[model samples]
Target chain A: MKAPCTVALDRTPLYDLHIASGAKMVPFAGYHMPVQFAAGVLKEHLHTRRQAGLFDVSHMGQLRLIGVNAAAALEALVPGDIQGLVPGAMRYTQFTGPSGGILDDLIVTKAQDHLYLVVNADRKAADLAHLRANLPRDIAVEPMEDRALIALQGPAAARVLERHAGGAAGLKFMSSAAMPVMGFACIVSRCGYTGEDGFEISVAGQDAPALAAALLDEAEVAPIGLGARDSLRLEAGLCLYGHDIDTTTSPVEAGLAWSIGKRRRAEGGFPGDAVIRRQIAQGVTRRRVGLRPDGRAPAREGTPIADKDGRNAGAVTSGGFAPTLGAPISMGYVRAELASIDTPLDLMVRGKAMAARVAAMPFTPARYHRG
Target chain B: MSETKFTEDHEWIRVDGDIATIGITDYAQEQLGDIVFVELPQTGDTIDQGGDVAIVESVKAASDIHAPVSGTVETVNDALVDEPGKANEDPEGDGWFFTVTLSDPAELDDLMDADTYKAFVAKL
Candidate 1:
């Protein structure tokens, strides 16, 4: 969630650790978070793909929906089949506005007694208000303000986490469990934003530093910062909250129709149900597609895109030099006709046209531990 | 005689005869993180002081390289096109962006020397 930096920023539980590790701190999502460590962004990104990287994601909001009717209440807001989520299973979904635009994307996990949610930091307050005003009165929305979230991601993440929590390595992807890590109670979810196989651990704020230090002590774990986190997720072809999917973009146009469960697709109870159903049936005028620029020059966010004939097509929402591919990669919305794979296009960078083309996403293949 | 000077934009210039070699300072490269691409000016291109001459791209963002003095581009470090990490490894030497034939040697007087540049960087 890349938001404008304001003067007053909060610090995460690991802020002192980041400073001690020589991290370059920057204001992010109302927090002074590390952008990169001494290893720099490139190395840190490559390392996470090969090994494991620990990220301080405490700035994100964690909340719980109590009462048995919570799942049904949330289903009224999103198109996902929240009621079908079995205990310990997680599902990725978005909060949609009445106009079919996405308010925010979040991960919801079904716990023993409540529905746990992890939402973007910048949108947390509004999300809370949305839940309180819309959800039924019996379903209580409790913010987990005392907790901190950290993600251990990459190929070696399972191994690093296994040393602390015995059962974590065995959990299947998109699953969660309450486990003890370094003797501290925590929620370990076998999932992450990076396309790599990993886990997100939620622990009490006070126990965060010790848990992070223990993970860093592992030979395979490196403390990754937000810079690598952004590039990694981009390479994974995942949509960032504000950049890729915002209030102006809908689930179908954003290429997120697959996230809408089959049951939810047939039943029309959620917000923007009619608009989403119409788009899903008739298709959207503009569709988000992955782009690969022909040259080494990076096409950043908001760069204008044109069709081969030089007509306006769309604008890049997220573009950067993918360290994994050694070339510039981007994701943007284009006219439905131009969204096909291999459709040639031009990216206007500084008034110069750079050759680009639509490509298949997950620019780097997703390596999820499905077992 | 060769003399080195620095600019507030974190660029360094080494004057040799009528040619001036330019590259970003180590601190600038550090601030930029890993340099992935360095767009160089073509030889014979004329530039004025403070003109946008090159573009240095890191994995996350791009930065403009402004000319510190007026000159005509002479030679560029073509190797940086494929191995831009050189800018991070040896920013002041092999990572030099381009060399230009100075239009006016007097422009050097307006730049900071090594000592002043170091002091200037310290305050930031």
Candidate 2:
């Protein structure tokens, strides 16, 4: 049967490889991405948790802010203390708007004389514009469009990486190093969105397909699609841009206050400093918490969360049937008083009130290797 | 024995003696992707024609399974409660949703026959 015609919204370096794998291509973030492969979504999700899964996240934006004033210039826009980011260390941070709402969450890695960053694929254009408009003239914001980002996540991810990239085994969680993989030099970071001990490889776009193929050749590595990626991240309590964290959610309300560096809070700089500092001091009214449904039914996004008296407490931002948990799990914003562990709650699913309870941030334990 | 008929919604029903076994077509299961959960009505519930009698949830979305003909539900496929993937694995056999006692077997004439269903699925 002829495959459906995929309009190339944008093509990654591994576009041909995805097509050969019988992937169902869908437009996402101005790029044609594989939503699912021939094995289907369920199998793909299961495979990733059991074994290593390679994901083509090339659609996400990669950039570098160069010059001596780069970190200082970046600190003006984000809540992170960029100046204190030691080289080879990565930090999860967010770009805040004027009113203290999050513009987008991004990973910032300090390289030699430059600040390497990765942002959400859908928010690339806006993020670039935000950087250009806010950054000082001395700092050069260079977009790394020639690079491709790939994630190898699962229990066997470290072993697969050690075999492909010689020095990858030495890297600890949230740390990165330049290593040679498949004869191509790339930056490998011991971090991932799946809450597993995984590595995200930033390689030249031209070398991405070969490296991806090499990783997939290993018995432990499988090609995961976006469908599984979403489910895995949801299970890990990681927020997705445009869904969980948006331009209206602040770091305090999103339960990401830890991302704000202690130095930044004490020094009191960055945009919306007054509002964010106040939230950190007094505590935010609403906080993001994990919810477990009492029944087998999944409480999907936008489901209304209710208190004991049936009053609207919050709304579900992300939810799905967690394959790992073997039950319905969800994450949503709830009143600060109701964000305690094991607090009883209810989810309004399809007009029917379903019993639920507020659990911890991650429904499953994160398996990232600290060492 | 009367001929089996199919609906555009992908439901199928075959009448043998006084009982009619109902299930979703293979094409329906394929379109729904991997079935993770199924909510079926109790065996004795009376369902009107075209009314929702069951729900099938896939990884991507959820859909309601409508009663193909007016009838009183006789027995449900209890196996589906444990293994919903049976719908994807065998939509026409072990994946049968429920059995119903037809209120009016004459209503079967309104459904499409096997050959017509074959052609109907071809268009999809």
What are the iRMS values of all candidates?
4.7, 3.9
For each candidate, report its DockQ versus the true two-chain complex. 0.63, 0.45
lDDT (tens digit, per residue) of candidate 1 on A1-371: 23555479899899899999899999888899999999989899999999999999999999999988899999999999899999999999999999999999999999999999999999999999999999999999999999999999999999989999999999999999999998999999999989999999999999999999999999999999999999999999999999999999999999999999889999979999999999999999999999999998888899999998899999999999899998889999999999999999999998999999999999999999998
Clashing pairs in 1: none
lDDT of 2 at A313: 98
Show the lowest summed lDDT stretch of 10 residues, model 2 chain B.
B1-10
| Runs in model 1 lying further than 4 Å from the true structure | A1-6
Per-residue lDDT of model 2, residues A1-371, tens digit only = 23665655889999999999888888888888998888887888778888888999999999999988888889989998788878999999999988898888999999988999999998899999999988988889899999999999999999988997887988999998878998898999999999888999999999999999999899998898998898899889999988888877889999989888889998767878899999999999999899999887888889999998999999999888887877878999999999999999989987889999998867778999898
Error of 2 at A157 (Å): 1.0
| Residue-level error in angstroms, candidate 2, position A67 | 1.6
Predicted candidate 2 versus true structure: per-residue lDDT over B18-50, tens digit per residue: 789999999888777778888899979999888
Off by over 4 Å in 2: A1-8
Work out candidate 2's RMSD over C-alphas.
Answer: 2.2
